[model samples]
Target: MSLDSSQLSTAHSGKTDLVCYPTSHHILFWVNTVSYILPPIMTTNGNDRTTQWKTTIIVSTSLQNHDTSRMLLAQHHRIRFSDAVKSGSIVFPQSGIAFLIINPQELPENLEEAGLFDKIKKFVTVHRNSFLLLQAPFYGKKELDIMSVIQHRFLGSNLRVLPVRNNTEIVKGMLTIAKATSKPHVDSMRDRMSLARAHIIESSSVWEMLRDIKLG
Candidate 1:
């Protein structure tokens, strides 16, 4: 779960069995580099019996950038980027770390938005081994507000959040979050109610407050 590139590099070489999962909106140069260095492998138990296990890296990006992403990752034949998720043209693998890169601008404004939220939720639900990594550079109240809504909803659903400001941090954060093989318990009623009350007191929004209550 460590983010250190050197550490991850070691793991990628099979020195240690530690696996890192990265689901990104865009495939960074480093990501493309790593995929080539580490082809996915099936680990076995002490008895030398292969398990239903694999480590992967998935990057999802927008249709507009789909071509560009593919070109960048072209040298790494193992890496694939597609715009098929929206059209239901894609089929996810059974087990492996995958990167889902999507166009950030195409993301829904909130969890209630049509198509976007449901599509993402369905993807994550089906890929129980998946962990979502949302990225944005928020420099204003409006942007932060949007992130707050996303954070509240996902956190309430027991998804871990890691706020990062740079590529290094993003890589580190994703690895740290993905190492856990279990889903966290859903937020308790008291915790949910407390969040709702805080939102109400802050006069955030009726919708946001109600969303918290519903999640509880």
Candidate 2:
């Protein structure tokens, strides 16, 4: 089935015609005959929960006219443009996270010649918690090479790499990550996790055996 923003809205609201199958921590949903795995914000009852998380996105002035920025605005996210941020960068201030969006097609064939490493180094230095959003239509050799180089160079740094196919994926990735890392929501997730852990311990046969042995 074809998926659009409206379909995403319904899916996010836990009301969708599409059948979703959970795989570990992600949910697999089919769109346009292609399956996509999305990490759902799950509640205590195992229901996918979202729509309550919202935060302002600080966009660089260079991306003011970009499709990614427009898509975020269309999704009803509050966007504030600033010149202080690096060009093609977006900041989630509440989460202390920043993302530098780069188009793989625009990158030079010789990465070192383009000084890509220096640019990324500056970006990481500016934002302690940062991500590199590498946009590519497909994960061809070029894309993989770029991702591999960045991952190798940034090892042990406060930087992560997210590969996005389109503007839709970009927005989805950003929102999902920002919501999970932001305030109040992160705390709530911790509480739910603790409860889940307690439930597991209470229901475990090993725990019961240990208790019986101790009592005996």
Candidate 3:
């Protein structure tokens, strides 16, 4: 059974086929990303360089050729899809790779012709150390179905995939966390400053401004 992008998720359901990538990192962090700009990385595989969650891959195929977006990921070298597969097999990296955004529902015909099933089997040969960031639709139970496919394909006994879908639920979740962590009383200037600082930290950095500041 093949998994689609939406099938990608971190939810657990009675020993799910797809395992969410594990870690103790930020939603987005510095990675050895290729392509280097907006939505730079296409995929990532990891073993132990992560403790919680690491955003290592991005499905910016549209931005694959977009160098500005590619460079932002920190690493300079750009690994391609073809390089990912060697001798008709996928190999995991020693250190965990990050941020792999995949729309697995659709795969390259060349890859399929080369035997996708066989290749994935070899790739997941028990703790192969690869991580995938698959895409998904909306959010919820739909993730379970998406993850099921990825789980069955890989052969690694120790490989685990973490799933996250971009949706309204995520937004609501962040807001919920903020309220839970914050006190209702905003009675002082320091508290106000703290709130402002929290907002600044929580918000996504404006990349354009960051890119400019990085130049000097």
Top-lDDT structure, candidate number? 2
Candidate 1 local lDDT, 135-201, one digit each (tens): 4543355445645665666564523333444444344434333323222311222233233333333
Which regions of candidate 3 deviate over 4 angstroms?
1-101, 105-116, 140-143, 152-156, 166-216
The best candidate by TM-score is 2
How many backbone collisions does model 3 have?
Answer: 42
lDDT of all predictions: 0.38, 0.73, 0.34
TM-score of 3: 0.32
TM-score of 2: 0.70
Report the C-alpha lDDT of model 3 over 49-136, residue by residue, as the tens digit.
Answer: 2222222232234444543234423332233433344332222131232223344445653444746555445545532344444445
User: How many residue pairs clash per model?
Assistant: 13, 0, 42
Report the lDDT tens digits of candidate 2 across residue range 64-165: 999988888877788999999888899999988998998877998888899888889999999998889898878999889989989999998978787878
Q: What is the lDDT of candidate 2?
A: 0.73
For model 1, what is the error of residue 18's alpha carbon versus the real structure, in angstroms, after optimal superposition?
Answer: 12
